[model samples]
Target: MKVKVAKTAGFCFGVQRAVDKVYELIDSSEDPIYTLGPIIHNEEVVKDLENRGVHVTDEDSLEKLPPGSTVVIRSHGVGKAVYDKLDGLKLSYVDVTCPFVLKIHRIVERESAKGAHIVIIGDREHPEVVGIRGWCRGDCTVIKTSAEAEQFNPPAEKQVCVVSQTTFNYNKFKDLVEILGKKRYDNNVLNIFNVLNTICNATEERQKEAKSIAGEVDTMLVVGGRHSSNTQKLFEICKKECENTYYIQTPVDLDSEMFQCSSYVGITAGASTPKKIIEEVQEHVRIKF
Candidate 1:
């Protein structure tokens, strides 16, 4: 059996930078360190950081922190309220929010200030989306599916600014945008609507790469945290291309039985996955199957 791993499979630029900064702080910083959330969606990385004395915290828990504690904002990025709260607490912080995500925040903040309704195309409850929502100075909407898009009924004259969560599925983002365009409101609304493709380049490349590899393989393995949005999107894309797709977080989750009928296996990982985990999965497939 030939097992092919995606070249784009592993930590994207933002995730790599955030994780690296945390480890650097662990080695150099004397103050107690905490992340506003898990630095990334990967459980293993978060657990490792916790074991090394880097505690995971939430915005509500900021007040409970001991004095002189330093907080690291995770790549998911928080809303403006979080920064304000941090300042109110007078706690020092290191912001490692992904640049792509930060760009969306700025766009939402700017557009909403100008009286445009902000429309975010992604999961409403996702930290990233929640953060993006916090940036809007005016009305904001989060639409995750075609049904949501169909039901979206903003005032006919509302000037809209549409942006996507950086890790959202590229094709789905397009579909949602298309649905929004077809909504039964004023025809002029499309003219005033500004749709920005905010899905990061890394995410687009990874999803496209997974689709291509999955089409050519007899079986596909998608590796990442179960709760990882990008990883889940990859799994969804791969499953559509190849029915024999499996989502696994680690080598232990792999079952040899799933590969019995496969001659060519394609492996791809989400943006937050670590290289070490991908390498171990690759090694396991090569040795066990």
Candidate 2:
């Protein structure tokens, strides 16, 4: 079997920034370190950090930390109220939020304060979405799909701005915007629709590459954390193109049987995935061949 790998399949800018910050802080400080949440979505990475004494304790475990302990905010970012809580505790910390996510929060805050209803196109429960919503003074709606967009009844009839989580699926964002536009015309709603392409360029480029590879290959191997939204989306995209797609977090998840009848294999990964994981998976498939 011939094995192909995407050059873009690994950590993107934001994940790299977040992961690097954790190491920088750990190396520089003697004080006990804590992350507000898992530094990144990958379990292997988080476990490695934990082994290094860089730990993520629950919010209720806050008091157990030393008084002067420094906290690192994860890349996905957190709400404004969470910052206030951190301040109330007089915690010293680093804000390692991805610049891309910060940009979305700014957009959400600015547009919502102007009395325009805000529509966030992404998973409602995602930490990034919840963080963006916290910035808005007026109410905002979160919808994951065109179906949600169709059924959604806004609190206000007119004046709205639309934004997306940085890692959200780009095509879905565009499709939802088009659906919202149609809804506006159907209701004769005087809309102030502003659609921002908040999806990161890295995500768009990697996904595009994955789709291209999936189309020509007999089977695809998607490597990344199971909880990674972008990784799961990659699996969905590849599965549609190549039905013999396998979603694996690491080489351990791979089966020799999946490769038995395959002539060509493609490999892709989520933005938060480390390059070593991808390389190992690629090497595994080659050995089987």
Question: Which candidate has the highest lDDT of all?
Answer: 1
What are the per-residue Cα lDDT tens digits for candidate 2 across 44-102? 99999999999896566666788778899888888888888888888887888999999
Task: Name every residue pair that clashes in candidate 2.
Answer: none
TM-score between model 2 and native: 0.96
Query: What is the lDDT of every predicted structure here?
Result: 0.92, 0.86
Q: lDDT score of model 1?
A: 0.92
Q: Distance (Å) between predicted and true CA of 91, model 1?
A: 0.3
In model 2, where do residues sit more than 4 Å from their true spots?
155-157
lDDT of 1 by residue, 41-113 (tens): 9999999888999998888899999999999998999899999999999999999999999999999999999
